[model samples]
Target: MTPSTAEHPQMSVEDFEDLARHAPETVTLEFINGKLEVKPVPDGDHVTIFMWLLRQCMQARPDLDLHPEQGLKVGTYRNGRARPDGALGPVGHFAGQGEWADPAGVLMVVEVTSHDSGTDRRDRVEKRDGYAEAGLPVYLLIDRDADAVVVHSAPRDGRYAEITAYAYGATVTLPAPLGITLETEGLKDYSL
Candidate 1:
């Protein structure tokens, strides 16, 4: 089963969307598992790591673009919404889809762990399950605290059938549809 608390949703999706629209730009908001989530802003280390991935991805597939902080409709039946750190897909894949875009054509989603109390549960687990359920082909989690990159792929039955963790400086290969390779060595330099 997907990670969700259907019993008591904090508010309707519409209400959350409305609130998100009016929210101050300084804060990022997300709705996952029927609960409101305030995503912590990315720190300098986090920013550098994502930019490193962006460079690698661009070099491998200039045809694709890794959009940062792209809002996506995710989770069971697309009921949940999230703004992954990066959403990689064909250039302009999200064109004209204001705010939240459907997960279709989104090859991979990225989340760089922030130094916060919720990093483990929010990024490593809940987001993983949600992206898998959304049928997103890949969910790449840069686990800063663990000093590893966790790749979640092959979604089937609302879960990733294969999960692999690679230590920093390892060569991580993102599977097909997104046939891009990553050399995580640069990640070490950004370590806090």
Candidate 2:
């Protein structure tokens, strides 16, 4: 059976943390606005693109730290936790944290669209808003469905004030703090 974006039974933060700690490693769960979202494990292409982007970020900004599947606390919602495809922050910003990093310390959040429609929607839409609302400086979205990379920045009033998009093979410049142009030359489209 294939996993879909069906919402799982809601659980408190403590319960979710306990389950997350003891659950099988195969389970990919996220708490979004008091709802437990069971996300499909990323496919190979997703991983490939993510790693490439991660490398780019590292090479461009060695001063910052990047991690894959890093959990984050967005806003004051105790039940909501976000695990971005990749998260960027100052080195050792969350060094002593427990299971999640504070959004205030995060400089950017990256999300690579999943093949699943619901998952894609969440990454492209819901997470974008959530990240902005959390006051994140940037939200980088690699949308396989649309074959484009979008950079959302300058968050204000629960949204980003600036957005720049580039199709595959085009370079997208990330504003200061990141201050780098991402090379999308080898980023694969989902259609392939």
Candidate 3:
């Protein structure tokens, strides 16, 4: 279930939105550097991991609101958009209507690795820079390939200044803004 691109090589945000309106609901696309990056639909393991994390966050921090597949405005170029696996922010931060929400409203963004190697690389590298540049406080990456969770924080210049990685079954402490520890017990490895 790889993503398919449009005939045009690049597109503006407005143009991407227009195309998305007619696109199938099952397809997930991210406009990046003027090109649409089609994302594969989530498999069962992906869904299970996402739900588990969402529930954990909700239970641990009832003050924050979590949204799945929520679009984020990352840069001023209008050349891209980012939709994290899960976005955490103050309650009602995304209550309005639009194709994307301001990155300022997002406290953290989480990305779970996909089966595609390219996608996984993008999540670990490209998207990390993008989120940092956008000034998001945290970027939590659940890397199935490594069977570990990595947290990136303290954005500076165009990257996170601090990073900590923990294997499954270990607790990862989120910094001040989040002020909570994520217990990774029972997290399963990817079967793909």
Candidate 4:
């Protein structure tokens, strides 16, 4: 059975869109199990790593467009909304509609770690299942505190079986369609 909006009662897609349209500065929204929830605003460290990683991906592949913190509609269904820290897909507007991202068309989704205790678990577990359900081929996790990267792949049966972790100074190569590599050594210089 699929989860419903009741699972997270605080928000809904319509409510979120209203906020996005009327009050975008209020908070960042993410839909989890059919309900909308606010995501924590990224800190300075988060921005530093995000921009650096974006640059890395852009430099390696000049053809694709990589966006930082772009909202997405999952499963061709309006119930799911996700704002990947970094989202990469085809280089064009949405087909036919010129709206929400094409889930099946995307190559990868990335999330940077949060200092909140529950942040890692949510991104690693809840979001892992969420992304897999959407058939996103690759998910990358950037843990700034640890100065490492975690790459999850092979989404089978609504879960990923392969997870590779890279520590500081290591070069992490992204999976197919992305073909980007992240440099870890410089991440330590990022301020909170």
Candidate 5:
């Protein structure tokens, strides 16, 4: 059975982390406002699009490092932290910073939107704000059902001023840090 975004009783971040540590591997938890929300894994289309996008980035710049679904802490005072679908960073970006690189230094962040209502809202709204507030320059959203990719950039005063969308067959140009024109053909046959 798939995980649902049911309301979880309020718990501190530490509590959430502790629970997550012992949680079964089959489950994925995302903390929101001190509550742990179970996030269902992505469907076929979501993974397909994500892999294609990652491949594009890898092919364009072999030196770049692209990580899938890694936890990252952002926002001032770590008010909000999340594990995005994919995050791009320079080679050795975390050389002396340990395994996880600082979210503030991330080059790009991508979220593969799920069908769940709460997941969709969090990906489209909450994350957008969180990433912006952390000053992440580029944010990408791959909407499966919509069969579209949304790119957000140009953070001004802790908000994204430029938002664009591209459907299949369209070349989506990303902003700086993740500069690349993704061809639509590769992402066309995905379930989205």
Candidate 6:
């Protein structure tokens, strides 16, 4: 966790949300670990990867919807706000819910890495912790930089206790509740 001075976040979470609300449409904002981060607009390859995964999820679990770029309240206190590339949940799970919906029934969050300076901390560390803290069942990181698929699951005590990485051609089995097997050879076409 990023330490705060005087136990004060750079700005209150509420303040961050207000600032985010007024930010320009081109700007994507995320508050993680008491810090504000501008998420880079995804590149073509990033979008392609997400779309590819979206199809897989839809085919495997027709009952669930893989929502694109959905805002979510993360962290144990719901203080952190994150807009994941895709949030998988039961159909209509976000209905009647406002912009920043609670993460309660969200089964999995997917993040396709953007080639950016902040991808390491933003996707691999801070956001992972935030999603884990929210007690979501799964976190899937399609790491373009590493050419690997990382599955984060088994959230326990504000962190994911089980993390596994698979190579591009490997078949990865997402655990129960999200029991979909991914044939990741298709990912290689999008890799650098």
User: Per-residue lDDT tens digits of candidate 6, residues 79-166?
Assistant: 8889999999999999999889999999999999888888998899989999998998999999999999999999999999999999
lDDT of 6 at 157: 98
Model 5 alpha-carbon drift over 4 Å, by segment: 1-9, 94-101
Estimated TM-score for each candidate: 0.96, 0.88, 0.89, 0.82, 0.85, 0.95
| Prediction 6 global C-alpha lDDT | 0.91
Writing each residue's lDDT as its tens digit, candidate 5 over 38-156 gives 77788887887788888899998778877887676654445544778888888766557542346867888999888887866788877787778778889888877677888999877
Q: lDDT (CA) for every model shown?
A: 0.91, 0.79, 0.80, 0.73, 0.74, 0.91
- Model 6 misplacement above 4 A: 1-7
Better of 3 and 6 by TM-score: 6
Pick by TM-score: 2 or 5, better one: 2
Tens digit per residue, CA lDDT, model 2, 3-103: 32213336677787777778788987777655667777989999989888878988988888888888887633433678889889988877888777778
User: Stretches of candidate 3 above 4 Å error?
Assistant: 1-9, 76-78, 189-192
Better of 2 and 3 by lDDT: 3
Greater-lDDT candidate between 1 and 2? 1
- Output the better candidate (1/6) by TM-score: 1
Worst 10 residues of 6 by lDDT: 1-10
On residues 62-83, what C-alpha lDDT tens digit does candidate 3 reach at each position?
Answer: 9898789998877434246878
What would the per-residue lDDT of candidate 4 be over residues 1-192, giving only the tens digit for each residue? 455443544566677666665646757767666555567888888888888887888788877766777677763243577778987766763446333565767778899988887676567776667787777888888876666788988778767778898986788888776778877788768734
Among these predictions, the greatest TM-score belongs to 1
RMSD of each: 2.5, 4.2, 4.1, 3.4, 4.6, 2.0
**TM-score quality measure for candidate 6:** 0.95
